[model samples]
Target: MTSLPMSDYYFRQFEHDGADAPAGRKGRIFSAICQGDAPTRKKLATDMALRPATVSDLVMELIHDGLITESRPAQSLQKGRPEILLTPAPGRLCAVIFHFVSHTMHCAVVDLAGTILFETTEQVQADKIDKQGFIDVLSSLAGKCTAHIPGSAKQCGYALSLPGIVDEPGKRWVYSAYWPKLSDFDLSEVSETLGHDVIVRKNLNCELRARTSRRKSLGTGKTLLIHWGIGIGAAFISNDRELVLTEGFGEIGHCVLDPLSTVSCKCGMIGCMEAEAGLWALATMSQDQSIPINEQKFEDYLQDCTDKSFLKRPLLLMAHTLRNLTLTLMPDEIVLTGPFVQCPETFQRLTERFELIFPEGALVRKGRKPKIVSGRRSKSDELVGAAFDLFRTEIGALCRI
Candidate 1:
């Protein structure tokens, strides 16, 4: 099935009581400090055009609420009195992240500071159960993880990353090639089961791309991430903000790349990007050539390709598929990630082909070119991004207040 447009997927509705509280003077002050390098009441007040008294009151409230922590006094540069610095209190709150794969579910617990304290992976019986069974397992896992958290944090939020079209508006799993029975299921049942105060279910590719966009080390601005796994999915980020969330904007993998090609995608389509570049595609291709290609073999092949010595037909096909995607999207940078990107030779050839196709104008201008780099935090990006989702929500709440 063809994916829906971004405009049609705004199903979920979020309301904040403090969103219209006359822009609390103290809240404004807090926002300025939170957005800056070193938080100072005086500077915050000045930035927000509020009185120092108001800023001080807001600072005290934030400190008392365990949201911000005071640091050592700042060194006086000019002469007068030194000022105290404030920063976000790390680990004050935490979030749980679940990435639903084709045959397994990956889970992690992350702190407000974006640290993954724990993670686990377990194989799932994808073909056996109905909707309720999937929800029960996921909910049970989330409950267990939340209970395992060391402290007595009251607000526990969840983020689920799954394949296929997620109808955020309907809070349902619209479609999945791997989990066909889950397509029409209302996934929110898991949230209700866990009883978490806040729950977010999003496409895994979108969450991954959001994590990549928020990575400070990458220095990425606007970019597209192409994740090749059980399915081919894409995520888009512009100007450091995720524009595709809840909008279904990055279902490029489901886009029909070849109308007449005989290859069929799990989504019941022919010649889709997923059919072309997905993990199953590579595995199928490898098996056809009698190249033993399970998960371990896939990893070994990737290592060989990365070393620049291997160039099998399957790897070449993967490269050509990526090249076509890069040409079509023309994102500032196209990030090839997920398990498929593990193949070194495949990745190199893909990059080589990408350069060959666009050459100079590929992704960037001379000095300002977008660099395609390997994802460093493979396992943690999703969890960190999930934490960031809550962080953003909290920030938005503060803004509204």
Candidate 2:
């Protein structure tokens, strides 16, 4: 799924009485501070176009609630009273992040400032676990992380990252190639069992959100991220700076490239994009060859392979798909992630092939063309993204405590 499928309650948390109301004002002020757009009371009022007195009132409420803390600047040369800078109070409100890496379930406790206060990982064979069994493991991991929350802090919420097509609003995991046994799994009861609001998101969406947040420039225009790995998927951020969260928005891997082809996809479809160029297909093709296949060192393997002719067909298919996607999205930037992008030689080849499809000056309209670059996909970023996303959207509820 392209959308970071958030739970129904997650969206409802953003509902406020009104923008002029106390709760709305406090949430906005808190978000501005979190984004570093407002660091002082005066700045908050100015940036938010509110009266200084109003800003102070809401800020005081946040501080009193332990949502934010203020301190004097260390050095101020020409000031009698040093400016009191405002920042999120560390260890006050934390988010528990749960995501899967391969078959491992990783849990992290992250604060508002994107710090991972605690982290632990457990291996779970996706194929073996039933829906309830998966929930048990998830609950165990969540319990472990939440138990570690500082005594002074409150649990803001939880974010669970699932890989596969999902029903975001329904809170259902529809299907995943890795977890064939877990289909149409109901996640509505997950929050009830965990005793907190759980926001479920797609793994790719979390990764892309993290990338956009880290690089401020990417936030201004349309950015498309394509993950070409064991399971292929995509996520897109529009020029309006909103993630396309429509349910099942980015499941390009299931797009049938050829209906007549017999190649099968894990999704039980024939001639899907993944069947043609996904990492699984590449790995299968590598078995008969002399080139060593090491999943752990896949990047090195890609670089070491002297004969790259085997990569041509897959790379061509990927390039064509990219070209089609670019034409439709017209993004300012295209980000390629996953294992294939980690290899410099392979990345260069993929870019070269993509450029060939769009000739020089062919796509240069209004002196603008999509800039393609490789991006890193890491577990830490996913966790941080999930935490930050929760903080931004649910600040109103979080500020209450």
The best candidate by lDDT is 2
Report the error of model 2 at residue 45, Å.
5.9
lDDT of 2 by residue, 92-186 (tens): 76899988877888899987656789988889887898988888888899989988999988787888888878676687888887788898888
lDDT of 1 by residue, 1-401 (tens): 11111101111112222423345444444444444677677777676566788677778877776767777664668566678887766456667887865578877787655566667667777767677787767776776677667673434577776666776556667776677677677766665677764455555544554454544554435666766656656666654333544557557667764567677776776777666656566557553453333444655655654333323443445555555555555456667666556755456666776566546764443434346765522555555554555555654454334
- State how far residue 50 of model 1 sits from its true place (Å): 3.5
lDDT value, residue 234 of candidate 1? 63
Candidate 2 stretches greater than 4 Å from native: 1-23, 31-53, 72-85, 289-295, 361-368, 398-401
Cα RMSD to the true fold for all candidates:
7.3, 5.1
Per-candidate TM-score against the hidden true structure: 0.75, 0.84
Give the Cα RMSD of candidate 1: 7.3
